[model samples]
Target: MADSAPDRYVLLLVPSAIRCQCRCVVSHRAGRTDSRLAARCAAVASVGAAVIHFAMSPTHWNDWMPSGVFFAAIAAFQLVWGLLAWWRANGLLLVAGVAANVGSAALWVMSRTVGAPFGPHAGEPEAVEAAGISVLLLQCYVVMGAGWALYRRCRAEEVSAIGRSLVLLGATSIMAVAVTVGLASGLQGHHHGVEAEAGHGPTTDEHLGDHHDEEPTAPGEGAGAQTFDHHSESSVVPGIVVVQPPAAPAAPPAPDDGGHQHDHHD
Candidate 1:
């Protein structure tokens, strides 16, 4: 069965939840003592690493260099401040960030082995690269969420922290899965729609042949017949013909740009 509009909308919400989770962690840790100090240091280091990484790459360096620098700087600041305010909390955040990076790098390696650079392409090979990147991002988001949960648990009142963290994690995970699967399904549906349109003309004969073995029904018989049943004391009207129209063609699937796959080449 095809995905519904609501399902696609839910899918688009997944990445947004992931992004919100990342921002929440950064924001929540911003005011903590160890978190502040660690955030600053981490920000600087992240910026430096990003600069070096961008410098090493010659292709579209101008386009990506700024973003790399920005994320690095943000990471460094967030990490330093977070660590300074709350050492344990900041540590969890750092670990999450590191795990995300490692996961992304692993995906990049897999893509290289498969001969698809982390960019758009024409076939399943290209799709594999895209899928790898999506999985990597999802993993990173999950880690960040886990870190945020840890931070919350560390700082909140003992009575409520654990419960709140569990709730947040559960909600985010459901959103993530729903969004990713919905978007992927939507993309697949689009590809199928295109193929169907392109191949529609010649498939009529094939379809007919597949259905040819069904037994023929006599006219005015079976469910196709119009009939009236009358009891001894009942009067019935006749001469009414009921006709069922052919079903309309299904509409093309909508494009989901908001859920567009992230490009994680660097």
Candidate 2:
């Protein structure tokens, strides 16, 4: 029997902060001071990660980023943030979350407007959809939305922070739907523009340039003259080929006399 290779194990060292957070982010994975709030935070943050995962793909790497790399970053950030939120809202994490969301939203708008840094992603629908979601969650829901809710929760007892979270979710959902419609409309407009450009471009009316043109009917020309007009046509090429019939072979030259010709006697 052949000898089997020994098994080997490899371990990768992760940062303390990330290690701590990872344990916290999983639902019911660890003991938290407030389990209810932790679960809710984890759910939202995990959903953000899932949304980004749906938007991005590993295979989407190209000269132009397939919008996947950007979303991957967001997913990573959300996971970390969710873990932190489970334990408590550390001011640093809150600030980082807000910054990440705002920066991403700005970058998304820039990409759509002028495609800075990475140029553009071949007008991909998936890319556009990803950008729209980023706007909905990070920009609209997290930064603009959750911040205010958290503040209100601190200020008053009448409104529950849960209500704010629900409102934020609703807003994000509405934004997603609206953006989807807008994206469809914009794509349709662009397609029509492309069709118009194709229909009327300088290349569309093109004709083969190499030609032989005959002169207009001459004053004395008859219908038969027109029949022979082909021979007189003006050609782009000055040279013309002429074909002639092969000549009949001449009778073999009168056999050469053998030097003496007999005179005929009368």
* Per-model TM-score on C-alpha atoms: 0.25, 0.40
Local accuracy by lDDT, each model:
0.43, 0.47
Error of 2 at 254 (Å): 44
**Candidate 1 — worst ten consecutive residues by lDDT sum?**
186-195
Which residue pairs in candidate 2 have backbone atoms (N, alpha carbon, C) closer than 3 angstroms, thus clashing?
Answer: none
Model 2 per-residue lDDT tens digits across residues 110-165: 65554545435434322344335434553445564335434433232332566646
Q: Write the per-residue lDDT of candidate 1 for residues 2-113, one digit (tens) a residue.
A: 7698899999999999988877775664443233433333333333333333232332233355434544553354344334323343564657555645654564455444
Residue 119 of model 2, lDDT score:
36
Candidate 1 wrongly placed segments (more than 4 Å): 1-97, 105-125, 128-137, 146-166, 169-176, 179-200, 203-266
Candidate maximizing TM-score: 2
Lowest lDDT sum, 10 consecutive residues, model 2, at 187-196
